[model samples]
Target: MEWGPTGAAAVPADYAVVVDVLSFTTTLSVALERGIEVFPFRWRDARAAEHAMRHGATLAVGRFEAMSRGDARHVSLSPASLSEVEGIQRLVLPSPNGSTIAFALADSGAQVVGACLRNAGAVARWLAPRVADGASVVVVPAGERWHDDTLRPAVEDLWGAGAVLDALLDALGGEDEVTSPEARMAVAAWRAARLPDDLLRCAGGVELTDVGFVADVEIAAQHDVSEVVPVLVGESFRDATEVQPAAPKLRRVDG
Candidate 1:
């Protein structure tokens, strides 16, 4: 899995998975757990805010730089804040990487899923069945950009992808069973697992921890904490376990 530069580019897989562990995706998961109705705004903040107010939702805004006002009362999807909320109606989120990639993949022929370190293992288990069915999966890490420079392209997502790949490999076995180049790429990326700590200390991970979302950081870093895999349908995330697990190979591993 890799994070690609944003724009209206073609999505490269039969199934596309987006990872924004630092905030956007994490916040989306947190909001859903809190019973907030999440409506993805794509890249339009003004439109998202308008929709929230129109729906009688108390708007909570989040951005790439810092936590927004009212954000403290809600679960911050980003690494900078871990505040929890009971229920949120709408979340106005803007991330340096997540939102852009998500929106791009939204209309891709591929099935899009929201992934994070928190749900890595579950995701792997879930994908097993799909792979068995001949589905191609692409894991996209939302990459970090600093002052026009994209630094550490696959650090965070690679770790998460590696965990998922390891699980899939353990379950499915052998290169012949794997068909997606993205999946193969993910396995290659995991080669860095030999120095797991250094990989975690990369740019995106450091920023996430510095922002006080260390729990999220640690949770995402850990392999396979939950057997629950979250999938994006329309605009809402649903637990994959609620449905039958895909029948590919099931490999168990710690993230």
Candidate 2:
């Protein structure tokens, strides 16, 4: 399912996968790689400094729309400082769109994994065993809602999610087969034929380049950099490298 910033409501599912391809999700992945613990906050209700004070969590805010708000005590995930907080706890996060969606799916029954173009390949390998067991996988792309009708970058998440779906299919040895309607659409949108270029042209990719995080963008665009798959454990996420089969496929009606 694709959810916008304001639509951070919890949904029922076996697993909720969040993707904020452009920077937020990519930032989260980078932070975790650096050893920083990332805590998600709802965009509408998120007051980073206040929340940090209340929960004693460190604040890590991103600069967006050319504005920098909140306390200076927090760390900013600008392209320049992406590698600084490798192993710290990032209490409050205000990302362009990805962070909020991660929070929205926090309560989803299935495990939550932060996704970006960078980790798509690793994520697919991580989920290969699960899909083989018939687990219901829901890929949630934390997309944008553009006010201007002329250009909307939110659809980039859809393309990112499609790339993930394609990766999963390939892992399952069904690269040439359409597993479902959503899979087919994602494949079509990405033109799954020329995946690498398609991924580079995504909205998130453009934003990363503008911010001079093109290297970071390229890193996130890689299939699987680490075998470590980040999964939410209690309040924070830990690296999960083992892939377990799903409990059992549940038959449900999607009306």
- For model 2, give the RMSD to the true fold: 4.8
The Cα RMSD in angstroms, rounded to one decimal, for candidate 1 relative to the true structure is: 6.1
How many residue pairs clash per model?
Answer: 12, 10
The C-alpha stretches of model 2 lying farther than 4 A from their native spots are: 1-12, 44-46, 64-74, 148-155, 175-178, 191-216, 241-255
Best-fitting candidate, scored by lDDT: 2
- Please state the error at residue 47 of candidate 2 in Å: 3.1
Question: How would you encode candidate 1's per-residue C-alpha lDDT over 1-255 as one tens digit per residue?
Answer: 555544214435666777766556665555544445555555546776686666565444443433545445543345334335544555555454776677666666556666666566667676777777766666777766668666446566666666566666667765663445776776776665644365447776576567655565554555444444556555545565444423323232233
lDDT of 2 by residue, 1-255 (tens): 445533334334555567776656666667667666667665524476676667676776555422244333446555235555444455566654666666555554457777766677777787888767656567777766566622244656666677677788889897543255765676576544344554566665676678665665565555455454567655555556433433433434353
Query: Cα lDDT for residue 121, model 1?
Result: 62
Best by TM-score: 1
| Candidate 2 steric clashes | 10
